[model samples]
Target: MSRDEHRHIPTLKRELAEGKITRRDFLRYSSLLGLSAAAAYKFAGDITGVKFIPTARADMPKGGTLRVSMRCPTIADPHIFQWVYDSNITRQVVEYLTLTGHDNVTRPGLLEGWEASDDLMTWTLRVRPELKWHSGRDFVAEDVAWNLNRVLDPNTGSSVLGLMKGYMMNDAGDGLWDANAIEVVDGKTVQLNIKVPQIAVPEHLFHYPLPMIDPDENGVFGVGSNGNGAFELVEYVQNGKATLVARDDYYGDGPYLDRIEFVDLGDDPSATLSALSSGQVQGSYEGTIAQIDIYRGMPGVSVHEATTAKTGVARGQVDQAPFDDPRVRRAMRVAIDPPRCLELAHANSGAPGEHHHVCPVHPDYAVLPAIQRDPEAAMALLAEAGHPDGIDVEIACKGDPPWELAAVQTMVEQWKEANIRVNINLLPSADFWDVWDKVPFGFTSWTHRPLGFMVLGLAYRSGVPWNESHYANPEFDAVLTQAEGTLDLEARRELIRQLEVIMQEDGPITQPLWRSVYSAWSDKVVNFAHHPTSYIFGNTLGLNA
Candidate 1:
């Protein structure tokens, strides 16, 4: 076995033993690592005492239009998409180099396979051969190299730049872009020489914000959808609808549906629910927790749920007054009870958070002791911060996504006991995004990321564009850097422990719970599963009718 295979098999086994992955996931991952089917089945049987059987697809008939209701997608640019709704639309055309599954396993997508150096500083990617774009152009190593460079370029304003540039770009020169970081070697192979040792390179490639686009096309995606994905864009109308048809020459598995139509139901969740109820749409992008009961009662509708690391965070700008005091921030953390918030706001459908950004789903998450909620302690901290009479604050957040509003309301009521007065400023979703990062105190919705370090780097790193709190701590930043480069899981988790404590004690954000997200689709839809990250994978979905 190769060194990479040896390293991965043990990790997979450990994950399986810990109940993080199932026996089926073990077989799938082991086969991907070059283990034969018989060997993989035997290996799994020895561990779980269960026989592995492959499902026959001969009886499954496909060829129908699947309609889904979602928010209007504005920007067609793959790299600059800010919302999950927009990516859901663009993903039909473009594809990613890697795919992180619902189980949080990172698998090769466009690339046939990849190998990492011992130090994890270099990754050699082998692109799949005989793949052609929807435009009939060959997919090659240069396309991958071009997309990496584009993501690294500061001028592109790619959201992924925050997550990738620091590790992938060389800081020796101007530090804006590094041509040597991504090297194209021949037609089907490419290499990445990163500045730091990152074990989650493959998972990072599957970050929703960074889709692999056709290198020859112009920067934007709306001009034309010439991609290598299983679906080809027939038409796309921003704020209205989009239509896609299956590509006969797709390199990957079944794009079973003959066609797909995505209709924008506006920002209201009710519209989507109505569409699903009346069969106007076969599927809905995401349904709020409050709507789960309604979905359960509806006939011919299947409500799917995925326990995710996704959550909403209430943040106070550290650079601003009141919250600038660590005492005040700590007071806020202790004043609100996570369990109470989860029960009241989320209908007790999710796991409570510990005020730290890391989730239990993350492999490197450190298990810390529980923090008790103390109203008296919060009052004392406020007094120590020179707010003996209590402090009045305004929290800004979007009115949509019902759970955010529900969470904020619950926290506001809980804070009253601590002598903290809060006024809610509910803005429209569009209006809120305009000032989401600039608000003094606000709520930001976060999606599930494969790694804890990825979200921390994007949102907590000192001066990054998305750093809403404007929190700058030398010790936190240094620990984060070390944690990012550490490849050993145990050692990295040790560092994560420190980071978690620091955040709970002094960070500007208070996260109450990790959400249990829901989606509803027609009963006729087969193989349509809800992803933990809320990603829509239409290619694998089929309509039984």
Candidate 2:
């Protein structure tokens, strides 16, 4: 190769490694410079490697009253509801276009199957013709299109809209609904014109935030239990309880339970755990590590653990003082002992937090070097950053879940070794989320997403609404965009590794642990499977009776 070409190769590799461009973009740009795809892919592979596989689960028996401690947080509105328990309730009444399993494989959920173009920009989904909604209306491609529009509706402010950006648009120039963004070619076929190339379209199709519902006569989505799920909403009492009855005409897989009841515990873990132990409820929708330990010793109760997207993250407002400097961020990361924090907080039930929030159980986990606790190094960095007398910062958090409070307490002690003094400010869960964006330093519990790209786009990528740290990096964004566009798994994995490294070095969030969320079930409850998504699969569960 010529000297000029050799010089450009490093830049191209860096772009691909950092996710500044997708494989397709790289190949297109490189061909002009006379580079081959084989050569380019080899260079990318040498940058990263795969080392983990997500554990998988199998089918369980179906039929029983699956009583859960958590209650319905919403009126089952797929677009507005944001909690896992809410999704667990809504999923039974409405099915997704795809089914993402514990293995992280996307299968046909509401749709028979789906296909995408080579560019990954266009997608075609085939709906099952024989399916019928709970309203006895035929399930069609338009229903799928309607739900996508619901999420894209700007006024509604759907949380998952970040994942569908570029692909979904208000093409009509009138309102949030757009016919062209999602086109119904026929009764059974729907085509999606994505804003950008997204190889994980099928996997994201099943995301709870993008719930597919049969539109009411007014064209509203998820208004009155109009879904094609295995179970039909029998009755819903907002914030109190929700009851669903199994549907005989259900088109998809098992909603094994005959009936499912969700009783709201009002964010009271004590009440929820008490109900589970006393047989008042068959299971608890969410169980912390402390709760699981208590249940493990209880007779006839089983604890199911799954690697979740749920993580305890320490976010710093990088736009503010101290954290505005990257050295301060790195200093805080190295000063805190993640392993000991995990031990103190969760009895080591979770893995130490890596540079990024992606869980170790994820298949796409790019094994970056572990961040070890180094007080001397941390102190040195702080000293160099002009904090010779050490630094004092106040952090906000909710004291529930027990572990979160314990984590903050332990972290304060660990950081003291580096002369960092932390002041703890505890708030209610509702209060914390309300003013989370305003807090300069705080601990917040983030729920799970099926893909690493999903969370990264929502919280880390610059300019996104949920980018808590307001972190912006052109190269990192480029890498993530390219990874989304490329179908090559290995290349995507390599891009994720680079993304993790970037976040590790300068990102504002100091993630200490990726906690394994659990569901505790009574012995009478049979075929209760654990899902990493943290949503309960009520349709597949069965009971001894």
Q: What does each candidate score in C-alpha RMSD? A: 3.1, 8.8
Q: Encode model 2's per-residue lDDT on 253-372: one tens digit a residue.
A: 565678989898776688987888788898887787776778888888888888676787888988988889889999999998888888889888778888588776554667877888
Write model 1 residue lDDT over 248-329, tens digit each, in one string: 8888778888988999877789999998999899998889888899999999999999988888899999989899999999
How does each model score on TM-score?
0.91, 0.81
Candidate 1: stretches off by over 4 Å: 1-45, 50-56, 170-179
| Model 2 residue 461 lDDT score | 63
lDDT, residue 200, model 1: 69
